[model samples]
Target chain A: MQIETGELINITDKGNNLFHLIIKADKIADKALPGQFIQVYCSEGESYDPLLPRPFSLFRIEKEKGCLELVFRVVGRGTSWLSKRHTGSSLKLLGPLGRGFTDPREFSRVLIFAGGIGMPPLFSVAEVSKEVDFTLFYGARSQGELIFLERWQQMTDQIFLATDDGSAGQQGNIVELASSLLDSGSADFYYACGPRPMLKAVKRLMAKLKIPGELSLEERMACGVGACLGCVCRTTSGYARVCTEGPVFAAEEVVFNE
Target chain B: MNDPRLIVKVGQFSLKNPVLTASGTFGFAREYNRLFPVSALGGIAAKGLTVQPRAGNPPPRLVETPSGLINAIGLQNPGLTAFLQQELPFLRELGTAVIVNIAGFTIDEFAHLASVLDGETGITALEVNISCPNVKKGGMAFGIHPEAAARVTRTVREATSLPVWVKLSPNVTAITEIAQAVEEAGADAITLINTLPGMAIDIKNRRPVLGNISGGLSGPAVKPVALHHLWQVYKAVKIPIVGMGGISTPEDALEFIMAGATAVAVGTAMFHDPYTPLKIINGLSGYLDVEQVGRVEDLIGIAHKKDGLD
Candidate 1:
């Protein structure tokens, strides 16, 4: 199961600042769960300005190809370097880290609230929830920011779209749309991911509406695994790592910044 | 048939290989266990641990820009005592060398931490991080100033019998001076190039992206800068160097070694690829075999510096 660093390969550059990077790492992939993430070294031959690797969520994986796919935003120097990379580039990856989302087997009607870059994790959850009746309430700052909508639309039976600028579907925060849908008494269980402010507002709305939900939190992380404890969040139990204990947490268990 | 393996001696302990995971990148050797064996690595340099546990900075501690990332993680850790009780036991069992990295707010805190961990059986060494930018006052990082770096190194050296590796920050004007100071103050080795200082803006919000205005930048963007520092400092000091900065592949790791780094460390790459360290190791081995090179150490400082080119 051990692979030499040279064996890690980049299979595809799925454009739009996203990459379908393959590491030739099977053991790590086999053990990887839905909500967990991986740390990838994008630039092989060049050492740019920042000397550290960036952590990303495992977007999709092809076990047959022995490759792992990462859906990442080219936010900074790390990703910008990654975005420029072409095929046949080699990468250094450490992964399948952080505690993933809880399984959706228990819930009947699942609602996934995703925003912008947060859609990656929610996408994974949606893929796993194929057999279940789930409604993905997706939102973005503008219509152009809405990614993976068509592919998700094809997979799930119901998809709701919202944007802050109303360049697309129902305009407003995703929480507003989600709350209205919740009022209709259709959603049984909900999972959400998005900006911190959005997630905070969601947590508050969930409390007001008394909805049972699980939130996948995203905090700035050093080591996507639990090493640095850089991505700690205050929860009802105690301080827990977003990378280790969860990017996913029960709405009731976490204590957001009020 | 020379061994591609490397065994480096730092203080009283001997590391199987000079290679190690940089602090803040690899968790406590346990997080990667499910994917790769912790024992596979030469050692695990844990995240920066302070005297007391810290909550770290506010939200938006990290922002990705260009070929790098800016972070002000603020040294969020479980504190040394908690790490010793909760995480150390598992790390010790992984059969990998454990290097504890310390960041202190004051001279006494650093001294006290070293004293507390002195003669610890599980830990192989201590890496003093004098370069975190998030903290205020004494913690703008001891790595920024030569005297400050030396003082922290000397204080920690006097407190513990373990090998001390002083991790240098790249934000300084003269890296060589700081490197020399750490060496003269009894540091066993040096970890070059922490994240560089940076900032980002969210156009929609028309304000700073991160809650903290400035953050430390890491990833491929800093590799060239890191390599330059390593090369320059290598010529300035006799102590072994651990070079890291945007090292995302085996070739990158090799570049560091050839630039006079005794070993290389993996950092921001872990964010993009979690198995980066193992991949780099595998790559190095394959590369050595393909090149028909006997020992990996022979590649150290092999970069031919053309005189007039500089």
Candidate 2:
């Protein structure tokens, strides 16, 4: 992991609280792995109230010039400040931090579950494997919140889209849709990200089907370097840091909830 | 000599400077070693440890407030065995004093941890973490009462020969009483001002932000509260003090020293800048030279007495 100032290339609004930031950070882009994220300092200098860098998963890693792209939602003061920056602004990024997904070639069949903000790293995985038989299960509240569809369509044809209010594709939650798919032939491997409830549903779905996979967790973090115990996730084997030991873990190992 | 006066002594242990990374803030020295040299710090307090492995709290463990953040990590650490097996060797090699911060629910648990690490070759001191507010059982319960705090301190003090530093909570009504109790209980030093109890709620979802419902607040927001506690405790006890809470810069640290803290601990600021401890250490060096202080100890307790400048 490296900490360096990343030059902002552009910021584009994708709709429904989502924004895409493209930065030219050579060292981080070169080593970024799937499921790893960067702690981006949102404010310039030290005049900000929330004095912590917001964690964002790697959406796109362009290895040629060491440039990377991150997509996030403006939920609070940190992200709200981040959305106002223009090209030529520089911010410090500490990454590519945390454990990420392993090689896809190890598994026979891959099923990807991405919930809203979880789409970025799953997108990175799709970009990595050109020949793997993978199906992307993407979910969001509305079509406006579903980002990078055209880009995903270019990667694979087996993309399943679901929305909460029947606003985009299938009705009900994405995990329920993935649960129904498990009623048929099941994939040997699964990868999941998004909110905890969805991950819990997936944990149940994985247990019912006896499938093993990896999960990328999201947590509010400080010292993206894992020095702070702020981003811990509950596991059967003590607490694991989402910033260090994970952001990615054995889907079966992490205890979702009671 | 162009050297800056930076050595700070406490009990039998002497530090390179008075800038140690506080407990729960500096995770066992390995992670931050990648960003900067861990050898640059005066001391490194490992994460709060428990006898049994702790899974900590559930999702939404942290939230940002005005110039601060609330965290209820629930004392997540690999049990002592794994820490002894995995983390200790690395910490021992960090080229700085290694202080282990231990948390327990009972007096026996506290003594058990102290006894276990008592003669460990690398550990320089034992910082009893009786101030954690996140857990329901043994955390802040002991710190809130002077009697309970003294019992915990006495138990650990008897179990270990190493220097003992008792971390105090600011949520108490009178911190000086607890400080004096620990001092009389054989505590070698004290670390003032753990996170203040804090909570936040989401109006849209009608739910509390932290899964634990409430957490300890740290960062710049709690600096005043920390200084107040340090000031009060300084007048009550003769033991050395390590002042902390929302401390970010050299100026903030200097205030603690002048207010009667022999050393200062840096916590929440490390989240934004992993280089904060080193930055403060360098800044202190420059400050000592510019202020023309003969040594770092020369500035201690200046605010409590008459000074050269008004």
Compose the digit string of candidate 1's lDDT tens values, residues B1-310: 1133555454456656656788887767665676667777778888888889887776667776766778877887789889889978887888878889888899899998899888567888788988888876556567888998999999999999988998888888999999999999999989888888899888989999877788888888899999999999989998888889888888888889889887788877766566678788778778778887776777777774554224
Best by DockQ: 2
Interface RMSD to the true structure, each candidate = 4.5, 1.6
Candidate 1 Cα outliers beyond 4 Å, as residue runs: A1-188, A193-201, A218-223, A227-241, A254-258, B1-5, B11-13, B249-251, B272-310
Off by over 4 Å in 2: A107-109, A165-167, A175-187, A202-211, A236-238, B1-4
Q: How well is candidate 2 docked (DockQ)?
A: 0.65
> Highest lDDT, which number?
2
Overall local distance difference test of candidate 2: 0.87
lDDT of 1 at B60: 67
Query: lDDT tens digits, residues B133-217, model 2?
Result: 9998999999999999999999999999989999999988888899999999999999988999999998998999899999999
| Candidate 2 docking quality: incorrect, acceptable, medium or high | medium
Task: Pull out the clashing pairs in model 2.
Answer: A223-B271, B219-B246
Q: Give DockQ for candidates 1 onward, in order.
A: 0.31, 0.65
Give the Cα-based TM-score of candidate 2 against the true structure.
Answer: 0.93
